[model samples]
Target chain A: MSLRNALLAMLTSQPMTGYDVYKNFQTSVGYVWHAPDSQIYPELRRMEQDGLIRGETVPWGKRGTKKRYSITEAGVESFQAWLNAPPEYQRERDPVRLRAAYLEWAKPDASAEFFRAHTAYHAGRIEDWEEMIAALRDQSNPTLAKRIEGKSAEEARRITAYKVFAYEGMIARARAEIAWAEKGLELVEELERRV
Target chain B: MSLRNALLAMLTSQPMTGYDVYKNFQTSVGYVWHAPDSQIYPELRRMEQDGLIRGETVPWGKRGTKKRYSITEAGVESFQAWLNAPPEYQRERDPVRLRAAYLEWAKPDASAEFFRAHTAYHAGRIEDWEEMIAALRDQSNPTLAKRIEGKSAEEARRITAYKVFAYEGMIARARAEIAWAEKGLELVEELERRV
Candidate 1:
């Protein structure tokens, strides 16, 4: 997702300081998309210049001066138009797989160490995603809950069901990775000891 | 990986016509990387100008002349240096998640239908990857298998294991999506009937 569009979407929901945008990313949108403050703040400035969003620098009670951004008429129109356009294509460059391709270059012991850590990292991510989904389910907003409502007994079980599913897949894959890693480690250790 | 580096590496294995590079993409490299003919041919021309690779016109047995390419010493040095360098960082965009984000704006039924097809597509990919792995396993080349040896057990495992894990993850995730889509479809169908 374009950081600019994400910022505009947040502003349309309500006017927000850049700090507020940062918070939204951490709590909600960050689950699927991420932009560090470095990217966000700069994009915000560019958007202001383009007249897609208007910003006002205001001093708050204690938080000091911060630029509060709101979607301009043009911003909303732009976002709507963007929505009608085709989604950007997805591309993945999995580091683990790439490194795996060149594994023979490394000593067996070192390779084993790498896979163990790699599998563990993905497992952690899956766990974090699950925890986030659980928290979303417990959210108190009626409208949010309604967004998850089902006609029958099956569908109403969760909010962000898609994420939950995706996470489950990730977890399953991680486990498989762990299994493969363990087996590889055993084999490599033997080879290393012999060599 | 930069297509530049990838193309350079391929040339080091042997000289190839632009058509050969294109064919290699479909056969071996597409498993890890992809490039269209449009990108490949233009890049070949660019590399020739840069002196990274040289192209020669070779007459085919039956067909007209083809532009065959071979890596210059500079190209071989460049590719090996790249292999030792850090991998380029990549950002991935998931269109299914993007669609899910805007699900609120979609007809509930329409949203479900989209996921239903999306789930099936992912499921097919997982199955296909599994088949590819099985075929590779049955191949007799020890050099290719040797390519996987010597890494840590986890690393070695990661070589072949990660793909299966990733595939399984996709399947599980797709199933979860299908379940959610079915619920959404049921709800929308009920509403339609009521009207």
Candidate 2:
């Protein structure tokens, strides 16, 4: 989805100033989808002009101007339409993958160093995701927890089961990559000696 | 990384026609990075003017003209610089996340349908990734397997460990999403009943 769509979706939740929207992403939406302040502000402005949303200033007694935004009926309709439409899969362009593609470039002496760096980075990143998986698994968010509470026990269990499986998938992929890098390091070291 | 960078990196591997590059993505890079042919050809034409790469036409009987491209020294150096640079964290702007963000708009009944669709789609995707993980685990690629032959057992094991971890990471994330959707479906249904 475009950043514009994400901004519109956030506004539908509740009216918020551009700053508020930015904060919401950093705190809540940020975990699942990330966008920086740089991208968000420009998109907010553009969306306002497009009639997808409107801005209203709510001035504080002793504060600067804060223009809050809410989705127009038009915006909500557009967002829903966009959601139901077939999703276009964008390429996953990751730096780690690029490094792997260029693995043949590693010189003998640099092989160990490259592998070491990659191993360290992936190791740390995997841990962070694992932690996120754990927190999410708990259904700590009130909206999510309450939703879980409302379901029939069997239904809730089915949903919970899928979530845990997704988390495990991530963990499994991370472990796989780590192993590849480690093996690559060994191969590089051996080639280094021969070359 | 942008599509531009991906094209550049692919050229660094070998001079390839735009068609060849697109095919390469399908076979080798599709798992980690993907771009449609529409994006690739335009990028090649642009990169040519920018001096990042140069293309030469080769005639093939019966087939249309194909322009093969080779990365310039500058392109290679630029790609290397990008490798050493800090990774850019792009948010996963998934349709599932978008739906979650606007869940309030969904009638509990409608929400259940949305969640079911998302859960099924993600579950299938997770399964696909699992197949890939298994294939990689097999390590049947002759070039890569030969490279690994010389490594000490400990080093080989470490590398293997890293690869497995990364694979699990992706699977974990996928499973987590599936779980969320399933639970969300039930919650939506309950909410619908109340309203």
Could you tell me which 10 consecutive residues in candidate 1 chain A have the lowest summed lDDT? A86-95
- State which candidate has the highest lDDT: 2
lDDT of 2 at B166: 42
Compute the lDDT of residue A185 as modeled in candidate 1. Answer: 60
Off by over 4 Å in 2: A1-5, A8-14, A34-54, A57-66, A71-92, A107-195, B1-5, B8-14, B45-54, B62-65, B71-86, B91-95, B123-195
Q: fnat, candidate 1?
A: 0.03
Residue-by-residue lDDT tens digits, candidate 1, B1-195: 467866774565568898878887564445455678999999999999989999999898788788999889887666655544433433323444544554433444455556566556656655655665664455332323543455565544544553344334334444555565565455435533433
Which ten-residue region of model 2 chain A has the weakest summed lDDT?
A161-170
Count clashing residue pairs per candidate.
Answer: 6, 56
- Residue pairs with backbone atoms closer than 3 Å in model 1 (clashes): A111-B152, A112-B152, A181-B154, A184-B153, A185-B153, A185-B154
